[model samples]
Target: MAPRNGYTGEGGSSVISTDLSHGSVESGESLQSTSSPHRCHHVMRPARKVAFVYAATGRRFLGCPLSGPDRCSLFMWIDEAWGPVLSRSLIQLWDQAFLDSGRAARLQTKKKEMEQAYLELWTERSNMEIENQQVVNKLKTTILDTEIKMSRRLEFHTKMCVAFISSAVTLASVLAYVLSAH
Candidate 1:
């Protein structure tokens, strides 16, 4: 009979074997049975990935597409056991890849913040420059107004002096004519 999952163990617990051969004792089916009963018609039907568990680290295996309570007994090892040296190297490499990806994300966020700060500073500088230009224009207008007022005052003083001299000369002539008539 092709093992339909539920089998009793030494502790009388309902032990379900996700692997093809269940446990140590051989089952009715072969160890590497790809033509299992419950097969999904998906493109990657038999899910395959490297095992990251402590006991079977760096080993590649094919498992059932379903997980947890719905998993079937459809597991098979694709790669053989790795040597101690190779296993350690692969674990370290996986760790480094994780760390590098996190660091790269942080750096990207920092770059965006710096760009925002630069934009704000540039805007402030532009506003200050406009304000300075306005102040300079106002100062120039005030100076022109003061010069015009001074020019008008000088013209008025000159006219008053000419009129006073003409009046004095006419008075002196009238006094002479009165003396000659007498």
Candidate 2:
């Protein structure tokens, strides 16, 4: 954009001056000339840009280097034509990329869902293992209790049998002595 005082160029072409970019004009840096009538400041040289819209991707254009509301309204294409076949190919490739990106997004979501399901199944398996172990421990404890009770009963029965045998032997000896005396 031109400065408030404007820049007068050779051949009597004077550009309307209020649009200088935020750089000092005395830096002595030269700017490249443009095909338009607008004069460029040192810092506001015409910038080459590429279009990325569908078939126009890779097409180059020249516009004001400074970007803002008050910038000049100059833009021109600098790229050669892509012809009908290449243009169609570029459009088809762009469409394919769009479709593939959407598919990739869906696949990513599905992968996350599968991972979540696997984690839940793993947690459930761990819980079931814990419960099974608890049941086994309870069964072991009950078996030990039953064995201790049976062992105590067997010991009591053994003592009673020994006492009965001792009393019968003593009674037989006493009966023999009485018969001898008579």
Best by lDDT: 2
Write model 1 residue lDDT over 1-182, tens digit each, in one string: 11134332222223233342132221222123244344544433565433443325434455655555565666666557777877676556556756787888899999999999999999999999999999999999999999889888888888888888888888889999999999
Can you tell me which runs of candidate 1 are displaced by over 4 Å? Answer: 1-38, 41-60, 63-76, 165-182
lDDT of each: 0.56, 0.59
User: Which consecutive 10 residues in model 2 have the weakest lDDT in total?
Assistant: 19-28
lDDT minimum window of 10 residues, candidate 1: 24-33
Candidate 1 local distance difference test against the native = 0.56
lDDT at position 106, candidate 1: 97
TM-score, predicted candidate 1 vs. hidden true structure: 0.54
Question: Model 1, clash count?
Answer: 0
For model 2, what is the C-alpha lDDT against the true structure? Answer: 0.59
